[model samples]
Target: MPVNMAEDGNVAPGLSAPIGGKKIFFVRHGKTEWNNQLRYQGATDIPLNAEGRLQARRAALRFSLAKVDAVISSPLSRAYETAEEIASFHKGAAVEKTSLLTEVDFGEWEGRTVAEIRENYAEIFEAWRVNQLNVDAPGGEKADDLYERCGELSKLLLARPERSIVVVGHGAMLRALFPRLLALPRVSYFWRTRIDNCSITAFGADAGRFVLLFQNDTTHLKVAEGRIASLPLL
Candidate 1:
């Protein structure tokens, strides 16, 4: 809420010392071999594909027009590649990689699509969807783990003292973080907030307060360049 000074007649919240005014330029890594297979490529080091590279380029163009103070990303091949693409344009902006933003560790389900997982882990598969409980991914991180880590990343971004920052992260991790940021219910899955590859998400922040701006935007994607004919909508 904006407060107006009676005499000045100007709306001003009396700006406090700004935090990492860092705008997180969240991004989804490009396509991987597993992506083509429709598999869950979490915690796995999968590189981007040709189309994914192009998508990264398009995403960079979007950032080129924004105020990017720093670039931080997940320590995965795909995420790093996408960050590198953006750095190509902002030559001086360094890309920092951290494991905190990694996708959910899919454990036994890694590299396999849902169809395949259902064959053996049938009950677990069914349970996994509604398994929003504090459950584990068989051999992976629990629902709470991803949220905790991403939350840490969020706070770090807010404290950076920089005006804005960009974070390149995975979809599942992004899924986990969004709800927490919006004060939504904490669950493994929350209404399936899907984002496209090489997309950008923004959160408005000041002194650690967050307001969602736009999400899962892929207007930068070109029909001729992306693997998917059209960006998926959620």
Candidate 2:
């Protein structure tokens, strides 16, 4: 289904689309303290901050009237909490956790700031920052490994019976996996895509191909307080 926002900037009721297939809405988890600090939170299991909780609630309201058959999320607390908020609106939809959706393991980089990475792991950080290389963190998950994991998740979701699903996850993992889900090119390219906290992105499978109905639409976040969510250094 194609989600629309009304003239008043509220999520409009009656989301419908001409091209129909299984629908997947990918939602990034709400703001965590690490998010604001621009720290790498890979595999850290950080919870939602106060503002994040409110954002999750607003995101919940966005789906209050929609038909979500299933809600899937990363096992990480941030993602699971966000999924829980969204699933609350759909009485029948229970939050399902999967390590397949977890953020890229930053390894030694976890909990470090971008500035720290630049200084400590200067060469690799520069390479990743400049070319989006498929490099691995010191003792952590590599970009290529994360891509394959995402492929597995894609297969799992497509094989399921649910027609509509909501997946709450981290930005880096979603960036790596979504391109594969859409059958796009190198996952590195999509690592540049900005997935704002609690933003709602949508797509549908049509004729065995995924159609991008919308990307990173944060209109629902208007209901929450005004604060820009900066990207966390993954």
Candidate 3:
């Protein structure tokens, strides 16, 4: 059996080699009022703004060209709808949703603004800013809990050797996800990584261990950074 190292994104320390398995793309759901406002958007279920819809459309255009096998998304309306848009653009694709992929549940602070969170729960908010796995949000899940939830489910998907899939979900979730792609360290989630709206990233697994191939590259978004001159050299 291959070890599930995606919790830390590690390579050799935890056994590294392609187990003839593959991982697919991880895309953050498009922006929303809360996202643009920098609010604690955990499980609030806000729909995409006009900007977000356009962003998803751009992702759809790109998806139409790429070859993806399936698409998964958070069960929230925003993510579910966004996944549907991408699914429609693809050839008879299915957009599936599951609780495992949902955004972090904020409990009492679900729809509140960041400023409100800071004002009402300053210390707790501070801990979150630093990415504490032990600190629960008001009444919601902390990083580690959500990680294991999404982590195990995602790994199950990667266990299959076939199927190039896409996952549409929230930023905080993706933040937790990126660092764990190869099962490195939980603390690595906050190493200045950013997952933008409708961005695309891909990874591969050696045996049960995973390896990151691409990360947050939305060049298909028609953004200035997507062009050839903007990409970095390997």
**Which of candidates 1 and 3 is the stronger one according to lDDT?**
1
Clashes of each: 7, 0, 15
1-234 in candidate 3: lDDT tens per residue? 785665444445555444234557777887788788877778877999988888887677666656667888899988987898788866756987778888888888887787888889999878877765556787888666877875777576667555567788887777776666666676736447777888877776555656677778877666642443334311
Q: Write the per-residue lDDT of candidate 2 for residues 1-234, one digit (tens) a residue.
A: 664432122255454434466888899999999999999999998999999998898777777767789999999999899999889878889999989998888899999999999889999887776544377788788767777898899888778788888989988887777788778777365446778999888877645556677888887776333222221101
| Angstrom error at residue 161, model 1 | 1.5
Residue 153 shift from truth in candidate 3, angstroms: 2.0
Candidate 1 TM-score versus the reference: 0.82
The lDDT of model 3 is 0.73
TM per candidate: 0.82, 0.85, 0.81
Worst 10 residues of 2 by lDDT: 225-234
What lDDT does model 2 reach?
0.80
lDDT order, best first, reads: 2, 1, 3
RMSD of each: 5.9, 8.3, 5.6
Per-model lDDT:
0.73, 0.80, 0.73
Residue 68 lDDT, candidate 1, scale 0-100: 65
Order of quality (TM-score): 2, 1, 3
Off by over 4 Å in 1: 1-22, 131-133, 188-190, 223-234
